[model samples]
Target: MARQVISPGWKVVIGSGIGISFGAAPIFTSGFALLTSAMAHEYGWNQTEVAQAATIVLSATMIAYLFCAWPLDRLGSRRFAATSIALFAISLVVLSQVGPSLSQFYLAAALFGFVGAGTNVVSYAKAISRWFDRKRGLALGLAASAQAGGSFIVPLAAHGIITRYGWSAALLSFAAFEIVVCLPLVAWLVKDSPPADASVPDSGSRPQIAEPEVAEADIGAAEIVRSATFWKLALCFAAIGMSFYAIAPNTMYILTRRGDVTAADVAWIQAIGAIAALFGRILVGLLLDRLHARVVGILTVLLMATSMLINGTATGVATMAAASILMGFAIGGEADLMPYLAGRYFGTRSVSKVFSWLLFAFCIGAAAGPVAFVRLSTLSDSVVTPLLLLSALQIVPVALFLSLGRYRTAPEPAFNLAAAPS
Candidate 1:
């Protein structure tokens, strides 16, 4: 099958639209960090408590992924996704209304976790993969770039709002975006299966997506696992998540504490990162199908290494901004790669569950990376040297991906075995 242009397919278009806006969602990392300032000023909370709050948010998201993981595939992408975004919106509203208690923080974090988990980095890619067959790689990447896209615009919006109306108003504004933009887009664009499937009601009689040049014969979940392809993908992504999570989970705090950056400045830097990712996701998506997917992984790992190193040695605004942009590219490239490769290789059979299980590795990394940086920083009174050393640690995973390349096997097609047509 030929690569489809970015415009076709309701699932791809709408999912991508929702995705690009996701940067500004409530409980975003920037907001989580700013919450520290809010708490400190409003109620005199310490950094440890604030950091604990961020961890709670991450934990909630991890737990929610486990809770909703399977029904996701069974529920179909649209329903699973729309409901989740709405729940996220609601959670944000709740969070914005805290009344002097940390328990309230935990409760709001838990709800945000439940609703927001599936709307994250990978699930949107899976949604596009479910509906499109040909050019699945490009489609998933373009759609997933929404996160980078969101990362770009949302931070600025966060900065503007938090800087002006306060974090409370900022949360409310993002909550509004989730309810108005993301929820409705999901409702309109997504379907349960290929257009040809008999159960896809009111789908307007669209034909199944054209099967591309690549056959699905060996790309199903069962086949993928039997082949070395599955482990290779997982191994690369595990390392990939570790590299990014190391930077993202506590980016604001680190910049503020070590670099003496204001939240507003971090927001601007992150916005620039988002712009870099926009091009990166779009270009990488195009490349994955034309070139070997392994190439994408290799380049992403390399760029991450450079970005981390630049970050380690930098002391000024210029160096930090450069690091953010490079990191953004690496981040966007994989944003497109993870779902695109999985769909291309595994054929979207059990994609949600499989992707979820794989993404749990990100959760583990998310949990560890920030704590690692924080601990190292405390031990040495800062994170600079440790961050630089982490740049070297990233090479281990790149080697792991190289091993993955050696074990690569072609995959077969997958079909639903359990569902009854609606």
Candidate 2:
């Protein structure tokens, strides 16, 4: 009998998963509603004002991604992640201590964005890309799913804390979790590349899938920025980030506006969406391994558009729940798609730099979405108009993805699980 051997790439996957689970994107995005509600109630700020906090975080994140790309490529993933996670914890502490001043809240949000930038998918994706080629989609999906996993847990836990102790306590609790748990795991498990000896698998165990040799010429940042494909991808993802952040973070407010739903109901609905996202990412990952990414992306965007339409027209909790499932599934697919596409089109030579610019586009949309949604809601005095507009915006990504053509680099040969050693 032979012992089953696991790839060290899987260790980085596990570590990346844990780090991303507590990363800024998941924590800030998932906890937005609770924080907004608490601050709005305490400070008498309006929806638009609280939404600005999200905007600030995204704006700062955009700047961070632009500047951090070079260092990320230079310093390696583990060091960059450990330092960023530590600072992110401090940002949470700063957030927990904010007073009645809205500026203080914005300041804290800025810190979270700037310092916590490395914790986002960009850092982990670079490491993962170096480690796996054949299973990159599945590997990325598994790791990225942690963002959805965090989304699932944060609301339930934060809501409970905010309900009992307050939003401050919730912030403190998350900060402590980052330091006490996430930081250590990342330092130990996350590696930029596999060990030299570990590159080859045990012949008696499982054969290792080697990283694919990319034949495409490496496109520098200046060249990539000028390419039509880059802009297309940028535009596509910006729309995605906008539509998703606009709706996901505001689910509580959106539903409660109907006068029939309670906070608890919204929480459960979001939880359901998070669960859907978890499966959605993995499923998209599997599909990507077998199908064209453009086809998968277009279909996923259409599904999201449908969810937005359903949500806008929903009159009951049941209808909203159904919309959530579609929304969650689409959101999961997008999460997996971003890095997968970046790696596929750009190759890994300067993936960190390329992905940073792409993520910056996403940040622009994410920063604007919440604020734009609120302003539209104010003008129309209804969630319907803003949501419908979001649905319409999905067309941009669909069209752009259709035009993305083929992968610039060749994909590794498909892995056959059936032929693996027992």
Candidate 3:
């Protein structure tokens, strides 16, 4: 038997995974939880105040996603990724050096968000969309699993370093990893697209099934903005970002408040959640390829709602652990769905810009969710109230997603180029 060959597309997936594994999202979502308590204690700041850093990061990130869309298409992924990763490393270093002032920390968070935008899903998804049409969902799933991998590892590593050395040391180590490891790997393996002649499967390779070639239509920004489907997607994702993401940063706090779970237990629970997320992404991708995307999306949202309800009512370690697993799985599914839906509905011609607008909506929800959660907790003096409310809000996305109807099918040059927004 002959050896099976890997495609350049798969190589781009590998590079995308590695870059994302060490990118800003994981560090913010996982590592920052560990940092929040540590920084709050060290500086005599409230946990809520420290947690505002996430809001700052998301606010800046939305702006960056909007501005970077044109540049990402112009410069291409390789050059754009390299520059952003380098700047992201510097921002991490700056974060590691923050003094007593909360303002200083917030500024660093802003820089972290703005410069690190390229390292997020926008660029990687854009690149992966160019390469694999038949397997785009699975390709994106494999790439996104890296975020779960990072989430699983970052908390453990950061917890260890914070316990032994300090929070700053852990951040500095992350910066070094981005510089020494992520930078070189991304620069070497990532490309904008496959060779022009290599769209078909190689000779002697297993025959791949063909899917609807929506990217052929190549819808532009002007067409996308005018479409009703676009707004539905934006609303769906924004609600997803708000209702689901509210749980991530506050996981440790929620568990600790129970007074029975230890710090190590919390870490292990998060790790288990991340593992579930890893599988969830891959499984959802397979399902998306085989089934209707809206059906899969509705199921994912139900899973998220269930997780929130479990978390709100959890009284024991086992229940909390179960809640975490469900939460992670839903988060993973949403991550995969966002790009998959973007490519499917709008096509790839202006996917990055279109995705940027959707992501901007997501960032808006993300920035507001935690603050809303915290405020509700303070007002009602109960975490359960806010969590249950968020769980109910999942209905909004489920309804919106169902209304997306069918994917667009149009001939090539579907929209006039001259009318596209600058």
- TM-score of every model versus the real structure: 0.84, 0.93, 0.92
Please report the TM-score between candidate 3 and the true structure. Answer: 0.92
Instruction: After superposing candidate 3 on the true structure, give the runs of residues whose Cα lies further than 4 Å from its correct spot.
Output: 1-4, 199-218, 409-422
lDDT for model 2: 0.84
RMSD of each: 6.2, 3.3, 5.5
lDDT of 2 by residue, 33-67 (tens): 87778878988988777888888888999889898
Error of 1 at 308 (Å): 1.4
Cα lDDT tens digits for candidate 1, 145-195: 667667776667766787788878878888898888878877776654554
As for TM-score, the candidate ahead, 1 or 2, is: 2
- Model 1 spans with C-alpha error above 4 angstroms: 1-11, 23-27, 197-232, 257-260, 405-422
Among all windows of ten consecutive residues in candidate 2, which has the lowest summed lDDT?
200-209
Report the candidate with higher lDDT, 2 versus 3: 2
Sorted by TM-score, highest first, which candidate order results? Answer: 2, 3, 1
- Top candidate on TM-score is 2
Clash pairs of candidate 3?
A: none
Cα lDDT tens digits for candidate 3, 351-414:
6777788889888888887777877888998889999999999999999978977766322232
